[model samples]
Target: MSPEAPPDPLDFRPRVALASLSGEADADWARAGSEYAGAAFLGGIALDEPTREAARELVDRDRTEFLPADPVGFVDEQLAALADSPVQAGFNVRTTELEPLHEVGAVCRDRGAILEINAHCRQDEMCAAGAGEVLLRDADRLSELVAAAAETGATVSVKVRAEVPGVDLPAVARRIESAGGDAIHVDAMDSEPVVGDVAAAADLFVIANNEVRDERSVREYLEYGADAVSVGRPSDEPAVLDRVRDATEAWFAGEVEP
Candidate 1:
């Protein structure tokens, strides 16, 4: 008999996700914030040796980090913790090698979760280690990683940051689409219109991130063609989520003009 087909990658319920914030986004945090979100991406976990060392250094500097001895096992445990949650779960992971993506992607596939490749982090330690924003400049490598993760049959999303000098986000989005990526989680930073540029460039699901705190911010992103928006720093704030959720619902219901 043939193997079961993978589930649709962009099957989000409410069109809002709790973005992964390094060190802080975990099962418990997800459980607490799941009520107002359709999905939650847990952890910007470091998956390989070099990246782990970089994460350790970040920790030494008082920055939050998730450094698990057994990276794949930690991901499995985190996803397992959210098994009963109503919100769809995902992991935002960083690694310099393709092997770890395959390993972690397999776990995500088994657990029916999204495996988000981290190209958005700009931490000096991470970038110097060639695991984060370095991927942004190397679209070929990023696409290769996305392709590897896609092979696991789990939904794959690439978390990318905008306004990085010389990096063409729309071009990168097209590359991800060709590599079988299901979504583009764009940290729009100060350039909100880039979300629209990416959405127009590829058919992939576009998740706008950064500054998504209220109705105006939510509507702006939706109007710019974002399929959804993710809350980062303020993800744990019930009031903030409430506003974003209501705005999303209102926009979809046509109560608000674009």
Candidate 2:
């Protein structure tokens, strides 16, 4: 049998997003696997000044083992690879300081890669900086930024958090659609995924993530409306990436929609 075709986001029925952290090994590790169909921009974002320290702190806290001791060069390597890679790359960039987003988005567009704005990182260091949660509060601006990024013609996606604590998700989704984002990567941490509410994809796409610890949860995400679903931490468990890959393939083939 011919090898399974490489993942084409446009043709992908239900996709798997692998979270890529920053570092030589991290990137290499990501490139090491064929099981994961896509990558998430969930690594270091502090490449410039005034906030570099904060970015480092966040990485250290959230991904100590993977993050490098000297992150500036580390991030540069990742950026360089992202610039040079022929295949599509993944990203979960920080919006707290919108410095390098445009240039980065340009690269993604040129490469047909998907670039995501992360409002989903829950690290306390990131949350306190008026980035993830704070940015969520001003859904209007968030939508505008997402739309602006979409101007590049790259598949611009925004990864959002659980949307709890009185956070109105339908309102957020509507505004994101009104803007220009291609999709909202919802980290459905506390609740199951919801498709109808995301119809406002504004001609974009929706990729569900988080709380997908088992086969049943993955099924729920697709049934609920996610064009695709991301599975991470699962890869960290013992021999779990293989399981995730198998489960995702089986689930998509079944194509159970709600």
Candidate 3:
């Protein structure tokens, strides 16, 4: 069979995504939860030696991690398992080097999946290794990573965290857009209005995340100009997903208000 084109990041039907939760999110989790979401991001997979070691450190601290021997091959395996699901599949990956991003982007490109750069992980181990939240403060390097990922023809998204002191997320959003990124997934933390800031700054598809449990949170994010909303920790709970899905559908259908 021929390879399929990458899924359109801006065209999610339900406008809800199943966010990546470190070690828990995978093809199986995403496939089972696909019915309630328009997109499902799997794996905050560590792609390089430094990040892999950081992941190992996280594991020692009782955190889950995907430490595959062959990072690119692992992505292909995981994405292939989602081939029959209706939800758009994506991989949230961490790497300090540009080569691994390019390699994984190729896999995502061929598999019709989104390649999400991991800039939102706040784990001390990951940050100390210069992989996750470190990228939030280093917009120039993050932009280079996004550009490299985009070069492989995959739809690229940067998963970012809001409210990091000294980091201007809206400014970073513009850089991502200039780097050819197709989407920006923001973990809006306590400051939900940052979603609007990001939306106003760039033409990138904005996916607002954090504390999205029901119609209220869903409506709030959408009202703030987010193109979509993502469910984080509760993503594994079908009940939560159902409520989120309904709210998202309602918002898009004009049945809800701010």
Single out the weakest 10-residue window by summed lDDT for candidate 2.
20-29
Off by over 4 Å in 1: 1-9
RMSD, every candidate, angstroms: 1.7, 5.3, 2.2
Tell me each candidate's TM-score.
0.96, 0.77, 0.96
- Per-residue lDDT value at 161 in model 1: 93
Span of ten consecutive residues with least summed lDDT in model 1: 5-14
Q: RMSD of model 2, in Å?
A: 5.3
Better of 2 and 3 by lDDT: 3
| Residue 234 Cα positional deviation in candidate 3, in Å, after optimal superposition | 0.5
Expressed as tens digits, the lDDT of each residue in 1-258 for candidate 3 is 999854465587899999998888999999888889999999999999999999999999999988889989999999999888898989999999999898999999999899999999899999999988999899889999999999999999999999899999999999999999999999999999999999999999999999999988998999999999999999889999999999999989988755
Task: Please give the clash total of every predicted structure, in order.
Answer: 0, 6, 0
- Backbone clash tally for model 2? 6
